[model samples]
Structure formats: C-alpha cells, structure tokens
Target: MAKALGIGGVFFRARDTAALAAWYEQHLGVPGFWLQEAGLTIFAPFPADTDYFPANRQWMINFRVDDLATLITQLQAADIPVETRPDEWDTPETGRFARITDPEGNPIELWEPPAA
Candidate 1:
C-alpha cells in the first residue's frame, strides 16, 4: 500500500517571492529546503470557529526550534515583534511557543518541545 511518508514540502505564493525567500533564509536559516532534525511533526486541523490563530489568514506555519528564547531574541533584534503566551501556551507535555510574522504578515509559530 503506497502512502505518504511525511510532509515533503510546504509551498505558498508571495507577492515578491525572491524577497520573501531571502527573508526566510536570513531570519530563520531556512534556505528553501531545510534539513530538519528528526522529531515530532504535528498535523492537526483547528476547529472552524477556533481563534487560536488569526481568522483573516487561512493557515499558519509551525516550526519546531531547539531554542525558542534565543530565536525570539534574534527575531526581536531584527525588529520583528514576537507574540508570546507563556501562561496559556506552555506545558510539561507539549512545550513553549512564540509567534511572529513575516514581512508579508504571514504568521509563524516557533515551538520548543519539552526537554526529553
């Protein structure tokens, strides 16, 4: 039985594709195709009426990071505002999370799974 192993890629359109790609590379170190570390990959769909993320946007991208705090600092240094909800978002089972937006206003979630 042939089946999909994992998410091969995530493709999206941008107004200025080149500039957006460069922003991703410079800020997130994601050079188009990244060699992500082997770990859990969440594939959950939110409820239609849920307000977890912005309602205006159709989707949000979550990236698992080794160090969320460090990334948040770096992002802030680059003048990107990071939205954090430590009280409500962090947990012993899951992890800490922080949110940021791209130059084009695309929401990005940075997650750091609880230490194993």
Candidate 2:
C-alpha cells in the first residue's frame, strides 16, 4: 500500500487570477509550485459548522513561518490587516499564529512553531 507523500500544489479559482497570483508572489514570495523550506505541513479539516475562520469560506490556507513577529510587521507594512489573539492563538507546544486575508477574501493563517 502507498500513502500520499505531501501537498504538491494548492489550486483555486479566482476572479482575477493573474492579479491574485501576483499578490501572492509579491507579498508571500510564493508563485505557483513554490519551493518551500523543510518544515511541517498541517493537514486538517475543520467541522463544517466550525467558526474557527469565516463561515462563508469552505477552506483556509495555513503557512508555516520562521518569525511571526517579523512577518507580521512585514505584512502590516504592506497595508495588509493582521489579526491575532495572542493569548488564545499562541502556545508553548504549537507556537504563534496570525490571520490575514487575500484580495479575494481567502483566509490565510501564519504559524510559527515553537523553537527547537
């Protein structure tokens, strides 16, 4: 038997595909088929009725980062709104987290795992 190795890509439909793709490339430094650094990738399915993110959206994209604080600053500098509940979102085991949205209203979660 064989199992899935890892996610190779995340494809989605956008109203303005080119502009959306450029936003990701300019702000997140990732274009289609990004070469990410070695790190953990979360595979989770939230409850259909869960309010963890926006109810209107069915899926959310999460990315792992090295420094949440620095990244938050960078994102803020770019005029992107960032939201966080430090007490609720951070933990010794997991790490820090922040939320932001793309031009198309897709939710994105940035997580920085605890230092090893």
Error of 1 at 71 (Å): 0.7
Query: Which tens-of-lDDT digit does each residue in 5-96 have in candidate 1?
Result: 88899998899999999999999988888878899998999998779889988889999899999999999999999999999999989999
Clashes in candidate 2: how many? 0
To one decimal, what is the Cα RMSD in angstroms of model 2 from the true structure? 0.9
Candidate 2's displacement at residue 46, Å, is 1.2
Candidate 2, clashing residue pairs?
Answer: none
TM-score of 2: 0.95
RMSD of candidates 1 onward, in order? 0.8, 0.9
Off by over 4 Å in 1: none
Candidate 2 lDDT over 33-102, as tens digits, reads 7778988888999899999999999999998888889989999999999999999989999999999999
lDDT of each: 0.92, 0.92
Candidate 2 weakest lDDT stretch, 10 residues: 26-35
